[model samples]
Target: MATFEEQLKALESVVERLERGDLPLEEALKLFEQGVGLSDGCKKELEAAEGRVQVLLQNRNGTRRVEDLDLEA
Candidate 1:
């Protein structure tokens, strides 16, 4: 599995490539597909981090309990 930092770097590169605006139609579509995959990867990375933070904050006892993630009324 790619680390969070690695996924972030890949996401950044994808954005840069898209921003360059020089790709031909076929190549641009390919880059767009890759960007979508990278976007999902980034989202998964963030969700994983949020889960870990929840675990640490809640001090779960060998089981995950997510109440710690919500502190608003």
Candidate 2:
């Protein structure tokens, strides 16, 4: 499996290619689909990292307290 950074880089490359506007319709569509998948994967990874950060913050006082992170504030 590609690391998150690799996937992100690949997504960027895909966007650059698409923006060039020179690919055949079929190839462009394929790249677009791949980009969407990469974007979704990156989002999920980021959310997981955020959750881990929240947990660490809550444990700063040396007590292991797990709580749901409220991001709506």
Candidate 3:
């Protein structure tokens, strides 16, 4: 299985190919389906990473403090 970065790069390539507007309808649809799957995979990986980070922050320095992740900056 590809790492998160590799999967993201594949997804970007799929988007580029679809955006070129030169493939047959069936081929384009296939790429679109693959892109959706990749998108979902990336989302799952990211959510898991976020949960890991939250765990790490709570356990750091033996403090056992839980901090909300400020995803919105």
Which one is best on TM-score?
3
Model 1 C-alpha lDDT per residue in residues 1-73, reported as the tens digit of each score: 8877887788889789889999898998898898888889889888888977877766536765666445575
The C-alpha lDDT values of all candidates are 0.81, 0.91, 0.90
Tens digits of lDDT, candidate 3, 4-64:
9988999999999999999999999999999999999999999999878777887546656
Q: 37-69, model 2: which lDDT tens digit per residue?
A: 999999999989977876687765776666666
The segments of candidate 1 whose C-alpha lies over 4 angstroms from its true place after superposition are 59-73
Listed per candidate, the RMSD to the true structure in angstroms reads 4.8, 5.5, 3.8
Once superposed on the true structure, which residue ranges of model 3 sit more than 4 Å away at CA? 59-73
Q: On a 0 to 1 TM-score scale, where does candidate 1 land against the true structure?
A: 0.71
Using lDDT, give the best candidate's number: 2
Which residue pairs in candidate 3 have backbone atoms (N, alpha carbon, C) closer than 3 angstroms, thus clashing? none
TM-score of each: 0.71, 0.78, 0.78
Shift of residue 73 alpha carbon in model 1, Å? 26
| Order of the predicted models by TM-score, top scorer first | 3, 2, 1
Misplaced by over 4 Å in model 2 are 59-73
Candidate 1 vs 2: which has more lDDT = 2
* For model 1, the run of ten residues with the poorest summed lDDT: 60-69
lDDT of 1 at 47: 87
Query: Cα RMSD for candidate 1?
Result: 4.8
